[model samples]
Target: MSLFSGSLQKYGQIDILVSNAAANLSIDPIVSMSEKALDKLWEINVKASIQIVQAAAPFLSDGSSVIFVTSVAAFNPGTGFLNMYAVMKTALLGLTKALAAELAPKTRVNGIAPGFVPTRFSAFLAESAEILAEIESKILLKRLGTTDDMAAAAAFLASDDASYITGETLVIAGGAQSRL
Candidate 1:
């Protein structure tokens, strides 16, 4: 982030902030989780993101878009599986709306809850090549998600295309049902 701070200030007045940094641990139940593990997730996944926003808030221009790369765990709350990681993602929704209200009519801050994309974060879900096929059976698309799929959404949210949208969290979960 220091690299971003020192450098990219010249990029179109930094009208867009793609808060994509995150941390995910393998599936673990909360009962046996250690305080150390919980704190680490909150620090890196939650507070770190908020701090990034705090640092960039001053530089963000009106009409800018800040997209937080959040997770479906926020809504699903199998918060048990990822310990504090899920809790932090859940908190991000409220955070997004709060910041949006505070910075409204100016910067448009939003979030994206991506489903189980084929990334290291999800490596814990499946180890076999056939595992995705097995998991895809539950998702309507019958396929896992991709980073590009998410990039396009973020692009739309950050570009002038979504000028009227704000304080909303877009879900990119391949048709997975969401209660939010």
Candidate 2:
């Protein structure tokens, strides 16, 4: 069975939806990036979230929450290598606001922009001691973020505690110059 059907069968109703799928298919600059890589990035990073929301919209309960796992790169691309990934994440920022407006008064939509975390997805950032140290030095906390840190923010957004919150992307980047 599909995930939607399986979820409905198990839970009866969908209260919280978190669209966290992402991909960085290429590290090449935008000008040099291949069409296939761009397509893959768009498919996994942006379109997948929209598809999930579309499929789950019918089953989402009243006062339900929808959270998107955006990236700090949305606001600050940092370097050329990450430009395309940042562009896709920037699209998600817009998607979050638009979806929040579209689903308001019943379903809330928000997002979290995480900093450099040592996950397998971000292991490249920590591969070299010099690079890791440089990154950590830039953070006000002087440390990389943890999965627990991200989970806490997500849990808060998903819970009733954040009832008044919507259409906002929280930056959990340890004061890493995310915004102006």
Candidate 3:
């Protein structure tokens, strides 16, 4: 069975949907990147979220919440290697706002832009002591973000506590200068 059907079968209704799928298929600069790599990045990081939302829209009801997981790279892509990934993530920010307007008054749509966390997806950032220290030094908290930090933000957005909030992206980057 499909995910939506199985979810509805077991839960009766969909209340909260968090679309967090993303992939960084290439590290090459945009000019040098292959079309195939660019397409894959667009497919996984941006298109997938839209497709999932389209599938889940029918089951969503009033007071339901939809959260998209974007990244700090959306605001300030620090390196050229992340240009394409950043572009896709930036698209998600626009998608969050557009979807919020599209699904207003009933289903709320928001997003979370997480900072550098030492997950397998971002292990390269912490691969060396010099690099890790340099990154931490830039953060106001002087430490890398944790999964728990991201989880807390997501939980708040998904819960009734954030009922009045919509179409906003909370940046949980420990003050890593995501924006000017």
Q: Choose 1 or 3, whichever is better by TM-score.
A: 3
Clashing pairs in 3: none
> How does each model score on lDDT?
0.79, 0.92, 0.90
lDDT of 1 at 56: 80
- Model 1: pairs clashing at backbone N, Cα or C within 3 Å: none
Model 1: residues >4 Å from true position, as ranges?
Answer: 1-5, 8-12, 129-131
Worst 10 residues of 3 by lDDT: 1-10
On a 0 to 1 TM-score scale, where does candidate 3 land against the true structure?
Answer: 0.95
Count of clashes, each model: 0, 0, 0
Candidate 2, number of clashes: 0
- In candidate 2 the C-alpha lDDT for residue 75 amounts to 91
Candidate 3 C-alpha lDDT tens digits along 1-180? 455998688877789899989899788988899999999999999999999999999889789999999999898764657899998999999999999999998999999999889998988767889878887888999889999999999999999999999999999999987862
Which residue pairs overlap in candidate 2's backbone?
none
Per residue, candidate 1 scores C-alpha lDDT tens digits across 68-154 of: 888877887763456556777888888889889988887999999988787876776668777667667767887788989999999
Cα lDDT of candidate 1 equals 0.79
Question: Can you give the lDDT of residue 82 in candidate 2?
Answer: 88
